[model samples]
Target: MAEIPANSLRFHVQRLPGHGAGPAVVFLHGLVVDNLSSFYCTLAVPVARAGHEAVLYDLRGHGRTERPRTGYDPGTAVRDLAALLAALRLDGHPVHLIGNSYGGTLALHAALARPDLVAGLVLIEPPLGGDWVANMIDTLSVAALGLEDGTLHSELTTLRRRKAARLAATADALLNRTSLIDDIAASRPFTPEDYGRLETPVLAVFGEHSELLPGARELARHAPHATVRILPGLGHDVLQGGTEALRHAVLERLGAVAAV
Candidate 1:
């Protein structure tokens, strides 16, 4: 685990050094209120044990990374990813990508921008569809200003209030970055055409109970080379549920690459 500086942003990362040359898997975290440390604490070791280096980082405003006044756009996120990979000197190595929710969306953009830098992708329950996508982005803005005006989190219990308060604060900062909101709004979900262009192996995992099940199914249909698996009784946070099952499923997906 280490902290690396890239221009104005400081990325908190975890690297599992490998013995021989191998593809490095970088994890992109969801838009959570906590820092990147939360993700590393959960994913790094498991992924590392699977025969690849697992790298995870905090986004610009979340986690240990600095909360800049601006530059939270998805384009900036992609640039940050490229910068970090270059800083780590993993630019030439085959890259495995994993992202969830907003992070998954950013991962898609990064992979599209640097196909040669990517070997495989694992997208877990990305919210990419319908009015819900745009609505969620807009809700961030509303929730942000609403917090100040007392339109958010005024009616919850103590614990719930604390949680909502944190989310509200994060939303406030994220909403100020208009570039990010605009980029997110303009970005379309990966289409069948987009999947057709991606020859790299992919594993698209979804919680059987995820609300995005419909979208995940649609995405899988287009990804001819990708495997779509639904973990039974799992929700959005499959990582927290059924670890052994999750590990087995991930191993199954990477078995093809492991053979190579």
Candidate 2:
């Protein structure tokens, strides 16, 4: 893990160099309780093996990244991504973005905010426009904040032990201390016009049983260049056992990007 300063914060980053000269493929994991490790153990290595530089970083306030009390909005997230890419000199070229869960939300917002930095997008179970965004945000916030009862760490310590206890603590800090939840609630959701105006090619994957399936469909219907795929027997956690499928989707998207 590398520690880099970008957007005035120190972020934990991991990079896997690829064999080919194709555009880099950056992976972004979900919110609280998630860090670069999720992709580091799964897609990052595979993407690098497939000859695309894979960049993974801990989002602000998560993992080893410096956690501040404010600046948790979508705009701040996009700025962090932009600044990180620029700090690494990866901003000189367009890169493919593969984002899971809330990270996918950042990817979408980033592409909209800085189209020049993005080549394509691979969104796994993205929370799309409308009430989907509202509900997703509510669900995640409630789930995480529910741990603030102070019993969560003990419960996890009893089950999965120290590791789970640590995760619970992280969740506790993020939900109880930071302005993350309020920022998310106040942030703007993607409108139909946002998708209709989007020109970036997108490959959005959703599990057959995932509640995010509707959002993927809505994205496909509005985005001029978008494809939606439904993987059977999966849910919000597509990166868990669905790594192979997600890998194929990412590689296939890269191929399409290369052909362009």
Candidate 3:
């Protein structure tokens, strides 16, 4: 539980030091109810144990990171990552980014926006360009309206689900009070052309049942260095439901990076 100041915010980060010779790995979490803890408990430790430095930090307005009322778009997110790496003196060497859901999209943007800092990418169930941006905004907007009165938080609290209650409160504050939804709505989600320009190695994994699986196939089709893997009988929750397979996929990606 270390706090690092970067990009005008204090970010909660867990840096698992590794005995590797070079190249570090950073874990980016999904939007809303997710925090760095998701990866801290999963791939972070595994990556660190595999002898690669692993850095896991909560994104802006999520987890223990300071929440601002603005700057919730993909561009700001990518800048935050750049600033964080610079603050940690990790900008000297290219690092691998392992992102889940919205985090994966952010990682892709990072590679496109600042290729000098990224060595490779592991995107898990990322919702690529197109209707996903609108769908996400609509879902958040509806949840904001439903949570505006705080009934959901209160009910969760009354049910003794402290964790759920806390998460609901977090979501409420971010949705109703911040500019997140508006920023997302204004985003130009990644297109095939955007993917085509990315030369960094990418390993995108999706669940067979996930509606976003098409995004992985599209990425593979566009990015010359991209590979797609689909796990059957799973959906958008590959980070959780498909943990073991996901772990193997992550390690394999790291191995490939180390080999090259």
- Please report the candidate that would top lDDT against the real structure: 3
The CA lDDT of each predicted structure is: 0.71, 0.87, 0.92
Candidate 3 achieves a global lDDT of: 0.92
- A best-first ranking of the candidates according to their TM-score comes to 3, 2, 1
Worst 10 residues of 3 by lDDT: 213-222
Question: Which portions of model 2 show Cα errors greater than 4 Å?
Answer: 158-160
How much RMSD separates candidate 1 from the native structure? 3.2
RMSD (Å) of each candidate, 1 decimal: 3.2, 1.6, 0.9
Candidate 1: count of backbone clashes, pairs at least 3 residues apart or interchain: 2
Model 3 C-alpha lDDT per residue in residues 122-161, reported as the tens digit of each score: 9999989588998998889999999999999999999999
In model 1, the runs with Cα more than 4 Å from the true position are: 32-34, 130-132, 149-168, 176-179
- Model 1, 170-210: lDDT tens digits are 66566654345665666566666776677777777888888
Better of 2 and 3 by lDDT: 3
Ten-residue region with minimum lDDT total, candidate 1: 150-159
lDDT of 2 by residue, 91-123 (tens): 999999999888998999999999999999999
Better of 1 and 3 by lDDT: 3
- As a TM-score, model 1 comes out at 0.84
